[model samples]
Target: MKDLSDKALFALVQDHDERAFAVLLERHSGLVYDLVYKRTRDDDDTKDILQDIFISLWNNREKIRIEESIYPYLHRSAKYAVIDLAIKNQRVTAYQSLLAKQDEPFCHPAETGLIASELQQQYEQEVARMPGTMQQIFRLSRDQQLSAREIALQLQISEQTVRNNITLALKKLRLSLGSDQLIVLLPLSLYISSALAVN
Candidate 1:
């Protein structure tokens, strides 16, 4: 039940303190699991990603120099880990195809739903245009269902900053698509296709 800062825990870990490492894992496991679950929506995959994150942390322990709060670094690491996992699983193409199929669901709708769906599509396309980091954050938080606090812990940003960035991104989508469209588009917006080409 020791509440060590990331720095202290990291130091102990560097000194080969297995107990310290376990404590670090216990404290952050929920954050890591939540972030992974949001991205994957699979219990088994979340467990896999959780193990991967901790293993990566332990393996890289000797190489990392932590002068700042370790939360953001760990969070960013988890974010990248999920992205890497997505690539390995070959899920990116399937996900994008699913998003692209939204047009089919929207077609049956008259005026209101049609416009909402079209605007949603446009918003998704715009989200696709964003840089990789933003898209990853967006997907992890929105698609994977991680809260800003969990995201900040996983990605290491201040929760306020997470809120601000997500807000800004959502605001842009809303302005472009209208409020009605945003509701329909939120989930699809998380499907980022640009990074899939490289993987």
Candidate 2:
């Protein structure tokens, strides 16, 4: 396996040769990690994105086309993964800001209740739209009332990542729920922060 060229290793990998796959991983893992890390800059995001890249490579091995080397393909994959991550985060942030600006004072108790119900529905819908990892992180923090540290340990991720996911989740919720409805959801924010404080 060690004696095989890149093309040979890829051919073996496509043929279900685990040894070849391992060799390819070993040979290019550092390069892939560096490429992803340079784009993400955060240790946790880098690790998660790097793992996803390899998973994608393995899953799509049969479809891979390597004319000469695998470097270009891996590099492009890493770049696209990072870009997707950024776009997800940005969508969350933008939605949060837009929702924040829609804040207005409610006139009646009945109106408040109506808005709260609507916001809750919208929040659920938006959360459902999030990536699986983000959805899981958000639920653990919000529904389970877990602290960032606890959530990190449970998910086997960095506390920073847990916090980031939570932030993004809140932004997404805010965007979906709108600012006027956020006053109704104030307790939710308080609950999350309180949990964090305990941790």
RMSD of each: 14.6, 11.7
Query: Candidate 1's residue-wise lDDT over 1-199, tens digit each?
Result: 2677878989988886656776777677788778778988887666656655665676578888787456677788778978887775676577667868885653454766777666767767878976776766776777777765667779887654664566566667777766545544553322111111111
Candidate 2 accuracy as lDDT: 0.73
Top-scoring candidate (TM-score): 2
Instruction: Tell me each candidate's TM-score.
Output: 0.44, 0.51
How much is 34 displaced in model 1, in angstroms?
Answer: 0.5
Model 2 CA lDDT for position 115: 66
lDDT of 2 by residue, 1-199 (tens): 7888889999988986656766777788788888888877887677666655665676688998998678889889898989988997798799877767876632368886786687788777888999898999888877777777788889999765776677677667777776445545544432222323321
Lowest summed lDDT across 10 adjacent residues in model 2 is found at 190-199
- Which pairs clash in model 1? 38-144, 39-144, 72-156, 75-154, 75-155, 76-155
Model 2, residue 62: what's the lDDT? Answer: 92
Compared with the true structure, all predictions reach lDDT values of: 0.66, 0.73
For candidate 1, give the lDDT of residue 6.
78
